[model samples]
Target: MFFNRRTPQSAARPTGRLRLGTAAVAVLGLGVLTACGGGSGCSSEAPDSTTIKDLVVDVLAEPDSLDPFYRNTAEAQRYYRLVYSSLLQWNEDGTLAPDLAAELPEVSKDRLTWTVKLREGVTFHDGSALTAADVVHTIEQAKDPENGAVWLAAMSYVESATAQGDDTVVLKLSEPYAYLDGKLAMLPIISDEDDYKPNATYATTGNGSGPYALASLKRGDALTLERNEDYYGEPMKFETITFKVVPEDASRIARLTNGDSHIVPDLPTDQVELVTKRNANAVTVESNVSRLFAYPSMKADRPTSNTDFRLAIAYAVDRQRIVDQVYSGAGRPNSTYLTYGTLHHDEDLGLAFGAEPDLAKAKEHLAASGVELDRKFNIIAVNDPQVTSAATILQSNLKDLGIESTVESQDVAGFYANLVSGDYDLILFDAPASTSTGFAPDYVNGGLNSQAANNFAKFADAEMDDLLDVALTAQGEEAQAEAWRAVQQRDVETQGNIQLVVSQSSQAWSKQLVGYEPSALLWLNTLRDVT
Candidate 1:
């Protein structure tokens, strides 16, 4: 799931059901791979091996919930994807592909009606067959405002869903939405037998048609999964996979080095060398996940509401220094919200602000804003090491310009509360777009558009709204890309949110792990292909 910094609220009613296009017929196949090894401390020879049965993974935090509707954080979504299969799947290259659905839905000429064909022979973990009714039920729960689905706003265009037969499901939409397929790709389909009610407690186990079945869950300590023999798709290589929650970065790295854990995700940049030095078999995998920043456009009464003041903050940030010092050279400075390879990334638009800090220009813009320099502002961020470090750096930089600012570090939940309540002058946050959906209008619309549910910045502009409309409803990809480029250009000039850097998250795994691929989307289910 995308990283949302706000709490879930009552979702607005969807205008109509969203219709999307059919996917190609190609079914992805897995291939065996040659053994490869890397890391530094020990000799290059591979470690003595034993039969691979269980694969242990270390994560920073345990999932707050197993229920798809309640699990909003990226950490939770990683586990959710393993237990529940969606109608659509995102390929590593960011293309939408068929999952439980036999083929993509067929959209009507008006682009309002969509017919989806369910795959045959797929069974839930409980041995029940998947059907159109299950799809309908899952979608209904997701679209219902009472459910408070984290991604509810993305489905606001959907109006209704109906089961045509045991094998087919139909969707009706209010308007032509080009990215509807991508939005639906993230909706994990659950079985009708599952107790998935609005605002209910997280289910201890999941009943879905995925390759993995929940074996046991231990809340914040660990959760284990076993391969489902009756899965409809390719068989999982590992019989059991356990995700262990180790919140401390040092402990996580220690587990990987000590062979207690075979894989660890989100390894801090500063720990990369330590892990390699401790274990020769540890391999570091890096993927550019998102752009990190402090959004300052939340309240008009705040000094940041002034465009010049926001620009001053943008120009004042030494992005390279942040990347070097905070990330320890693990990330690259970025100016746009979208990642480098995503569609309509606007290379030129982000470059307008320049990569390096310009203190003189920042001072000039600050002077032009006419806000009182002595006014102290609050900078809020989650108490993560990197984020807080970056916040501290930003506070010091502002102080150098005779600007008074105070840093406030909060836990994840508290930080999200501050974000939704508009309680901070500068908010340190990050928004990651899935490779499949991030290339569309959803990223910008969610973060920058005036009425977007995730628009914590409270940015509103007529031209920005118009450009987004064009991008979402445009008839062709080229036209849509062009319109989105216009949106980026507008954002760069407006400085609604200053993107400090493109963040790169590191994943370290034992060299014995094979066929594992690091993904920008952070799909932990990719482990199914590993041996």
Candidate 2:
């Protein structure tokens, strides 16, 4: 019964087998809790990894901040899920299920209104009962135009959030949004109390109804969490969980082999074989969701603003070469905007830029663009090893086309700053894997559309925006398919952003961890079920 509390297998990929670790735990009993108070965000140094009795997860990137209101990085969301609970959860099969909510919301016939019922008796880490007001407050904070909420664009359709009573919330929308349920899964509920408002102390602290309580934080080094003993749902397997930031791949592998860490996520494909050879009990799993793409700055004066120039950049890069050399053949070259796991993905669309490099066509587009021969370009990317390697290849490809460019490597913070400033000619970015393809609408609208807060590329096209609206408002699957296909077709034609690689996600965990399930989106929300 070591894996007794496993969640149901995703219906989307029922045939996909999960490789489970059979390593026996030396001790099954709960360990003593950490001394820090829950949700205090207390500062402390990390314990010696080799000496810790509980779980220690080795992570590559330290989250920029703990505040979900402003921090939108995948790493931040992973930490947020530990400290807070949302109304719904996205399963690996792309289905939505109730989490804090008593059940799924009842949608109106027009799909403009949603009535949500709260689960009774659920209390936050502060011992306050969760109610409809908390949900309303969270939604309002997210939808506020001036709040600078990370999810503001995702909640654009929401017109109002009002509490019907202690347990019921009514949400009104300006227009029909089929993906409303998925949006609910993104907003973590917090108390309506003013102390927890945006930019308050709550940014560094926690007051959520999740299974784990934030015990202490060492900031960029590590964070320690203790199980919320008063959790209404099934208890977390480990009494304490520590997440240590290990940026180097070698160091993370070293930690895993030496038994200093129980799990190490974001394993590079090239290092998978090395980690498995070092530890027989180490179990690794792969998921198809990490989308690597290029965002060309579409500022009016930038050379990349020219559609022909963008298409030339897209066609010149050898995607298959990047897949083989950079990813160790663990990824596929994608030509269109949508990835394999996404809904309405047309395999036969045959994008303008094929997987293989077409130097002749690239030169033709480059000639048509009439870009100055001596113009230099700037390429921005995170300091990740694979990303830098791919950027180097792109630089080489552009050089062959008589384009001069320099690759600038930056940390996560610097990367985002450069991305939003519209100063760079082109930037390489990754969209973290998601369980729900339903987020496609928000991804298109918020990340790529003109006037969007996060539209770092500055891509503006009236037609694309109209296509996004159709995709978001489409009711039936058939209608949605048509709308999304039109959107993808337009993306291919305009080259607003070039799709690069659909990489597989890899994670290695110790055999001592039982019921350790692999997530398609790498959310790791099932840790509560892992003993």
Candidate 3:
């Protein structure tokens, strides 16, 4: 299933001038160069050079589609961030900043209308000037339910967008949403001439207004992007950048070690030591992504439907142990759904499952639940190795609590179907909050509020809904924090969902590549500044 995608952290507006760093000496590895550098888009001729004009990056998978509105996968979002320009960009600290927008949006007194002024002189790759009309068209397309836009949740409150003039656009919302500005950062502004159908792949040929333009795409092999010379913002350093799909972790690391690829992202935790040993000079960065286990509350007949049973399950598992064993010490135990560094994360709320498992507490909660001793429930998970490992760990933990659970793994499509249908008692999945804004109202609403579209767990609490409403419309930071803290407390008390651990995502790049820094958002668009 397609999870929410992250964007780059906002930093000082990039000057776009290439800033090269010191190059690290290449170390030869023992393995003969395999599929990565042999015939898979990487050049084998230069095995130790660092001064290459063109850059080849190893991505885990090819994007499902180039159409921003059609796909929400990380791969698709990464490509979209590079090829398309949004009205606003996120600061490194998760604050909103203007990109295509000339300045901050002006909101009406009632908070229903937002007037946005577009930056002048910005042109798409096709050389058409970007105007309020383009923004209006993009919003209208996403707001249409028939389009099945992945980010439709963020704009559900948007009533309509109208262009007042060549450079100003006005948006009317059904209700006041405090996160509206932050949500708009994810809605990329596209060319008005571009037409994309729902679930259909759009062959992008340099049609965006971002730093890079699509040069060519060889599906399942490589995607070539050339620097957009007419880009209005900071100019890209590399004239050409090619993303090579290297599905295997070993192959991607090999490409980086052999100097065939400049960067490789989403490195497997198990392969971290191997990458470091092979290429000691490679630069590695890590950032945490939120992960959780959700119980299907709508399944009233299931044991997980009972709050006491859910709490019992929570107390049975050791989150820190899972972080160390399953994630190979590349994860942090999270108390709430939000990452630790996110805004409004309350340390006082403490760990929900505690530092370790409390078997006695688990037993007490289980006894109170009054579930049949012989009852058997299934824990469903996506067929990813890490997710499966986590599921197995939880399964073993529940067994110790005298509970029987069978772990079932399915592919992404099947897994999402089961979640939506509430066909399983428990589901181990990743539900990350928006990293760009570092906020949780949207996330809480999406996962816990009764009216949320993605509430696969079928969890509904009046207190949670009320707190979310207050948090979303609160005018000041203190008010918002208070509301969010209460919401977190209520989630813990009711056992809305058990947050297992926050996983650290790793990205490896050649030391020669500079001007790139890791952000919690994990957006690859920052590659535009790397030399």
Candidate 4:
């Protein structure tokens, strides 16, 4: 059994529907292996026209770096979707789906070993055959600590990734990981070659078995790819795709409005009106990934260190307002830690934020603690547009109760280190979708447990621990999913992350854009421009 932060999904309802599954961590010490995703953040609804295909997405920002290993940034992975292919692909419902590697794994009784056979006839853009060697190299490069691939943390379950034969890859695990197949779906296989460096030019032009090929790329401006003619699976409809880089929020909206580009991402809620009025055609709330959890100062003496205080904050933030004002009401206000479309989502649970607009109630609690309105608190946030906006909203919400707060912004690396090092009173989630499903641990006992150093909020509880312990140790999927759902509900009840808003984005596109999966990842394969 893999020692994962994710607990098994024991209580999954047997009704298999086509809804997007939540990108949730699986039962194991490390949690489910993290996957790749396109840039920016937020969730959305399904497109009105299923017939709409052929895509030329207007990416609001270019990747900081395209080197797959060096640029584990969400923007980088978003670019990779045009070229790379991972072992498995996750379904919208959070089940184990396949992209390159076909089907789920056959696990042993103790559930430590898995045998995965490659789908035949899959070829890279460079005409290289994707075999067990390709899978091996991808895993090896990711596991290298020097590479610093965030997904590698989840791959800790592997003891060896050796080939059983020419086409079959066998992974021996230290522990049972029922969600291993789901994890592999995110690890797009890299082509095995003599001179493989993440910095090489060919790296940007991927050599995988995905639905498309990297046709052209620039360092920070744009990336383009054409459909893989040799691809062994369903053909992409779009002949080519251009990922145009536009950084300024207003500029992205303008491009979509002018029809200069299609499929823009992360349109700020304030600008949705301009986009909708101009294009008269936009997709909002069509895709989503939950941004849940809270980070805290781990020092024993701090108020944030108290589970109740953190819970109180969770209860205070109006998630619906965040979704409505920040996201333009594209998505539901989710209180459970697990995201929508997951086996663990507790549909029965309401918002994590407690009663509405009662400053007296909030002040009463603070006064009971002998805390005065003049007391100061520091909030550290990633220096990004959305983070700034959210921080501003949080400031306004907290100030009504006379809480004195100041917001500090930092670059990406600074943000991660600062939060992990326990330097922030509050931190907003800024990482991309790759870490989405694997971010939340099912219970308190898992290493990826939400209160750990990386958990940002620094919260832990005995109830959370006991519940997770039972879920992980117990057998069967139904029992596990139920326990995981219960954990999400518990977190909401406790005001865990106090998620203010799950951002929803609007992408402008001509009905010509096709093959886009229309999920958070903005999967671009199986797409083509309608002539």
Identify the candidate with maximal lDDT.
2
The sequence of per-residue lDDT tens digits that candidate 3 reaches over residues 181-279 is 777777777888767566553544547888888898998799888888898888867778788988777788888887788777667655755765664
Cα lDDT of model 2 overall? 0.70
Q: Rank the candidates by TM-score, best first.
A: 2, 1, 3, 4
Candidate 3: C-alpha lDDT: 0.66
lDDT of 1 by residue, 1-531 (tens): 111113211112122123111011011121111112323213445453345688898987766567777644567777778778888877644457789889988999999998889899888888888899899888877777666665565666678889988999888987787777877778888777666775354456678778888899987689998989998888877888898988888888877777788887677756656666675233233333546777784566788888888888888887777778877765566666544435555556655666677889899998999988456888887667788888888888788777888998776567665566666788887544343323244566766767665566677778887877777767665676688788878777777787787655666777556445554454564665454
Residue 297 deviation, candidate 4, in Å?
Answer: 4.4
When summed lDDT is taken over every stretch of 10 residues in candidate 2, the lowest stretch is 19-28
lDDT of each: 0.67, 0.70, 0.66, 0.54
Strongest candidate by TM-score: 2
TM-scores for the candidates: 0.83, 0.86, 0.80, 0.73
lDDT of 1 at 323: 74
| Lowest-sum lDDT 10-residue window in model 3 | 19-28
Error of model 3, residue 381, in angstroms? 2.9
- Each prediction's total of clashing residue pairs, residues at least 3 apart in sequence or on different chains, is 7, 0, 4, 61
Clashes of 4: 61
